[model samples]
Target chain A: MTTVARADGSAPELLDRLAADRATGALSTRAGIFYLSAGHVVHVESPHSPDLGELLTRSGAVPPAGWWEAVERAGTRHRVGRHLVDSGRLTAGALELCQLGALFDAAYCALAHGGTVLRFRPGVTHWLGAVRPVPVATVLHESWRRRELLHRIWPDPAVDTAPLTRTGGTGPVALPPRRARTLALVDGVRTAAQIASASAHRTFHTLVELRRLAADGLVAPAPPPPAHPATGAGGAAWDEPDTALLRRLLDALEAL
Target chain B: MPGIDESLLETMRLPGARGALVADWISGLALGAVGEAPGGDAEATAAETAEFARLAVESGTLAPATPAVPATPGTGSPPPPPGSEPPVQDLILTTADAYHLLRFVSTPFDSTVFLYLWLDRTDGNLALARIRLAETADRLVLG
Candidate 1:
C-alpha cells in the first residue's frame, strides 16, 4: 500500500525539479492543480478546500457584491485577485493572506493522497492571477506535515467524509473552544466538509476536529449511507416497473 | 503588513533563533518557514510541535472553564463559551541545548496556526524571545 502510495509521491518531487529548472506551467493532479510561474507555485486549487472567493465571502472579508463585481470585471483577464485589490474590495495584505491560505490548504489535500496522476501543461496561469507565489519546497513540506497531522489525530480516513452523529444521548461532553464551535454545526447530515462550510471554518481544521471528536467518542461514524436495497430485496420493484410506463403510454394514446 | 512570510522572518530576527515556522495546529501543516529547522527537517519539526500544541489546546483540565449556561428558556444544550480567543497563548519546551516556543496566532478565519521558534538555549534570551514572539503573533495578518 505504501509503495503504491509512493508512486504518486513523485508528483511533489517532479514539481521541485521543475522549479529548479524554472519551468512554467500547471501540474494537474488527481485532486487539484498547481500553477507555477518560473518554477514558483503561483496558485493551487482543489475540490477539497474552499476557493478564495468563497472563503473571503464567507468570512465577511469581501462582500458578495464586491466579489461578483471583481469576478465579472477581471475573471476574463485572469486577474480576479488583482481586481479585488485594485478596486479596494480587499486590502493587498488581506488578499495575500487569503490567497496563500487557500493555496496551501488546497495543496495539502492534493499532495497528501496517493495514486495521483500528474500532468504538466506549459505556460498556464490561474484565473485569480498571482497574489503571492510560494516556493515549491514550502508547499511540499506543508503537504507532508498536514498528512502526518491528520494521521496522528485519528489515523482513519473514514471520518473525513462520513456524516457525523452525536456519540450518545445528549450526555454532557466537554469540548474545546474550537470543537464547541464545530459541534454546534454538525447535524449528522453534514460531512466534515459540509460542517466546515456551514460553520465558516477551514475545511482542514474541521476535518481535524471531527477526527479528534470521533477518537473521543463524542461523535459517531456515519452508518454507511444505508446501502441501497440490494437487487434481491428490490427485485419486486424492478419486475413491476411497467405499470407507470404502460399508464403513461395509454394516456398518450388517448390524447392522440 | 506582516503576512505569513513576513511574520516568519520577524521571528528569525530574535537572538539565538535557529529556525522559525508558521504551522496550523489543527492540520499540523507549516504555512511558512525560515532559517534552519531543528534536526534539519522542517516538516518533522512542524508535526512534532503540532502534536504538543494540539494536546495542550485540547486538554480539558487546562482549558478555561465554560461560563454558566445562559438562563434563556429551553436552551436545548449549554451555550458554548463566549468569545473565540483560544486558551493557549504560548507554549515553551526546553531541552538540554535548545528551547522551542510555540506561539498561537489568532485570526478571524477558521483555523489556528502558531509560530514555532527553535532557539539555542546557550545564546537565546528566554525572556526577550517570549515578549517578541507575542508581538509578532499579534501583528500577523491572515486573510
Candidate 2:
C-alpha cells in the first residue's frame, strides 16, 4: 500500500503505477475521482466537471460574470451544483443536466487519455457517487451523442476552433445549409471579430462549430513546408549557345 | 412531480408509440421503458446512439466546413487558450419509422441523467411528441 500526500500528487502517480501494475482501483484527485478495472478506466467525476454553469449562464438562470467566483467557492466547498441551485444561479433541472454533462465530460476525457491509471477501492467514498471513472468505450459513446446533438443544431463542423473566416473571392458562393449558415457568417476576412460579433447569440456556438469542422476533417491549418533551394536546368552551368541556336532556327523558319 | 414510471406511461399514451424508455446515458441503463423491445437491445441501442453524437462532434459534421480566415499580415488571431470548455452536446436520432429523442436532465447532485424516448413513425407526430417529451421532462424526479 503506497500512501501519498495531496490528492493531486497521488492521483496521477497512482494512475501511472496502476497502469504499470495492471491493477484496478479507484484513483481520487482534487479534480475528481475515477474507477479503473483490469487496466481500463470505467468512470470519472471532477469538481468543476460538465456544463451546468454554462447552461445556466446561457439559459439566463445565472449571471455569466459570477461563474468564476462561484467556481472558486466550489473549490473549497466541492459542491458546485448545490451552490448554483442554492444561490439561484440555475434551476434544479438545469443544475442536474449540467452536473450530468460534467460527469460525462470528465469520464470521456479520462478514457480518451487511456491506459490503466485507474482502480476501485472497496471502502473509499468520493462525492457524486463516482466509484471510478468510466471505460473509454462508454465515454466515447456519450461524447459522440453530444456531438450529434450539436450537429443537428448547426450542421457545419468548420467553426470548432479556428476563428470564423468570412471573406469571399470574386464569385457568388451559395451559402451552406440553413443550420450551417446560422452558425457561420461570411465576413470579408475578420475571423475572431466575426465570432465575437456573433457571440451574442451564444458564446460557445461558433467555438463548437469550429471544433466540429476540425473533427470532420473538412478544415485544417495548412502546414508550412521546409525551406529548400530551387532546383532546375536554369543554373549558372546552362549553355549560352542554346539561345543563339534557337534564334537562328527561328530566323530560318521565318525565311522559309 | 411525476415519477419515472408515470412518465414512461404518459409517453406510451402518444399515438403510434412503438416503444419508450427512460435511459441514463451516462450508464446506458434503462431506468423505465414501455412498448416493443428495440431490435438491437436497450444497452446496445443507447451505446450506439451515444457514439453517434461523439463522432459527429469529433468529425465536425455539426458545423460548416470552412478554414478559419487568417488575420492581417501584421496580426494573428489569438489561439484558443488552454483550459477552455470543449463545445459538445447530447444527441437526438430520428428515423423514417421512429423518432428517438435523448434529453439531459440536471440533478441536484453531480449526476447527469438522460431520458431517451422512442416513438413509432407511422402513428406519431414528431413535432407534437417532442413538445410533449420536453413537458414531461420538466416534471421528472431523478433518483
lDDT of 2 by residue, A57-154 (tens): 64444577766666667645545545655666555444444444445655433433332433336333322222223444544455555556555644
Q: Which lDDT values do the candidates have, in the order given? A: 0.73, 0.47
TM-score of each: 0.73, 0.43
Leading candidate by lDDT: 1
**In candidate 1, what are the lDDT values of residues B89-121, reduced to their tens digit?**
679899999999988766555556788999999
Candidate 2, CAPRI quality class derived from DockQ: incorrect
How many Å off is the CA of B94 in candidate 2? Answer: 11
Count steric clashes of candidate 1. 0
DockQ of 2: 0.08
Residue-level lDDT of model 1, residues A92-203, one tens digit each, is 5456656777888778767755526567777777778878898898888777766776777666666666566666557777778778777777776777778877766667
Top model number, DockQ: 1
